[model samples]
Target: MTLNRRQFIGTTATMAAVLSAPMVRAQGKPRVVVVGGGAGGATAARYIAKGSKGAIDVTLIEPTRKYYTCFFSNLYLGGFKEIEDIGHTYGGLAAGGVNVVHDWAVGVDRDAKTVALAGGGSLPYDKLILSPGIDFVEGAVEGWGLSAQNAMPHAYKAGSQSELLKAQLVAMPAGGTFAMVAPPNPYRCPPGPYERVSMVAHFLKQNNPTAKIIVADPKPKFSKMALFQEGWANHYEGMIDWIGDDFGGGTVSVDPNEMTISIDGEVTKVDVCNVIPAMKAGRIAEIAGVTDGNWAPVNAADMSTKADADVYVLGDASSQGDMPKSGFSANSQAKVCANAVRGALTGSKVFPAKFSNTCWSLIAPDDGVKVGATYEATPEKIAKVDGFISQTGESSDLRKATYEESEGWYTGITTDMLG
Candidate 1:
């Protein structure tokens, strides 16, 4: 069999395994083991391998063969996209010189600089990048837990959960109620729950016009609050009843069996409930001992974890100051980390770290809104330098343009992350 340079780089580890041996490091080539192949890990892995030109060994550990992005899952729920449209495979990365491992990362041994797999093997690395995303905080929402997900799907992780929530939405009785228990601050996508609310309202408006939407939010205000409120009032008028912390929205509980939600001592039977509990870094970060209870703290300049310089954390899991926990932020952070790690591994030029993020939300049809900011790495943190956001009462044409911009960005970012 013949192999190109990139293909050879990808298959070297496999060849070592075939010989019942550990990965070969004949010439002191640096290896980077990335856990959680979402926006952050995949981009970092690909960038390192591509940038090094086969000088660095990059292996990505992700459980799923196909990854569905959480960023646009709401669009899927809103009927704007099909499930297949959001699903992505790792073949591109595998072909790009990254060894994509489809297995669960069970543990991390920082001393040995190795990651243990649930399938019973380990991969040693000179550097480890973790971007495992968010995990629900246990008992954050009373009466709701992982076991109750079928009855009240969070749909936060995308893929099957997103499909399950859509199915529940479709199965709702005519004019039945759809409820959401919004997560607390510092969760993935600050505007996500609200965008989801907009999408659900859009779906309900077309299919079940009489259906009602209720949101019990722990926050008094949310990202793009004024814009989302304006969109809701204009498009989904009288359809959504949002209970904020000021109105006892934070004080809530639920029952999956009865399909009911209680807010401020008032209980109401619900047809569909989405409980997005408080979130923390994915468990792997904690197991790696890089997390400070809830999130992994990292240096703003390079995204290297403070716990261990050789170990890096990215995306929603990292408590990098000022960046929202969105896929855009993860992708942005990944590039900086990749450059730094590649420089550390090889004699590459390391550039100054700069980051930017833009979060877009579709309200109803062509009505969309967005908020964004540019950031620089400061000694204290990743400090926001300047920002912009879609304004309230904007012309429909401008709003439509914003929505179109978001679509273009989606295409560009997905390509950038995987390719």
Candidate 2:
């Protein structure tokens, strides 16, 4: 299928195969192979590599040489940040003694514990960590595929497609229409598509007041709905249009070459179209027999796969209940999974793992909204204990401060991921 930069960044076929591959290793140190290097995989690889202090051999398999985060990509579209500000390198993990492999993983030999590489080589690991992230459902959007992505960019993963979307915005006519197809529920970043619409609207309001944005969402209610609606009315009234599922917001097909999206069998042409299809765990996860439905089922405490004892799955690939698949959640799960893996390898006492996640979305340059929750592991699942959402009608100054705080968090998280 046609993939945008964001979707491209989250691809994990190579990593999944690596985790399931079987091979022989010299008996010296335990070898850990981490697949996918966006948020969770990169964090786990770095932490395990550094925490073990050469006691463990860590090899990180990722298709890309660098990572671009989705967290602050909206800011880039709004002209509040640069692409360079959101991009990160794997040098930090390499410095931590991680053997970083920039190649695709094609298959895994679970019987032999070896991972087949696209380059015709295999790597054996004692323990495998899989964090390949999510993938788009192929037919979720009819007539849309990899070839169509060039004309209509999702910018979901936050790299080259992000740049393409930005360029499209810059080149659009003053009163052109920008259409966004919002995915169904249980997808990554519940508030993401709305936040993106706001950011794009923010840019147009300042530069091209006559321009407009339209959101076709399959869900009637969304994360931070009240706050976003309020922000749009107060700051960008008459500039944005939202159609809920009940109002035929669902997209049935898209012709990227024509810049047209079909909603409820009606064709609508636009200056720019961003189609985000339904998604599931990366394909490799499905192929390796780790996924239960669309995601991998794991032990709540350590995120080890229920289907296989030697494998651990985290991030969007794992079925983490009530926790939206955001960068923060992925990073948090990665840290916990890393600790559990270390404990398992060294024969240390394992602790009952606790995890937390916070997602911040900008409604305007200075206005932001946040949602967070703390989770505890139950026998059956990860259950939420305490959580908070941004208080309604908060002061503009407070929201602005929170926005700054979110920036600091982005910096801290990226450092934690690579460092």
Q: What are the per-residue Cα lDDT tens digits for candidate 2 across 1-419?
A: 89998776666754454344343234567788888897889999998887767767899989888799988898899999999998888998899899999987777777888877887898897788888888888787788776788898878778999999999998889799998888886788888898898999999998889998878888889999998999899889999989889888874678877788777878888998888888888777786788998899988888888988788887888886767788888888888888877766654345678889999999998898899999988888888999999977999999999898898899899999998
Model 2 clashing-pair count: 14
Name the best candidate (by TM-score). 1
What is the number of backbone collisions in each predicted candidate, taken in the order shown? Answer: 0, 14
Off by over 4 Å in 2: 1-26
Find the candidate with the highest lDDT and give its number.
1
Give candidate 1's error at residue 354 in angstroms: 0.2
Give per-residue CA lDDT, model 1, range 34-124, as digits (tens).
9999999999999999998997889999999999999899999999999999999999999999999999999999998899999998999
lDDT of 1 at 132: 99
lDDT for model 1: 0.94
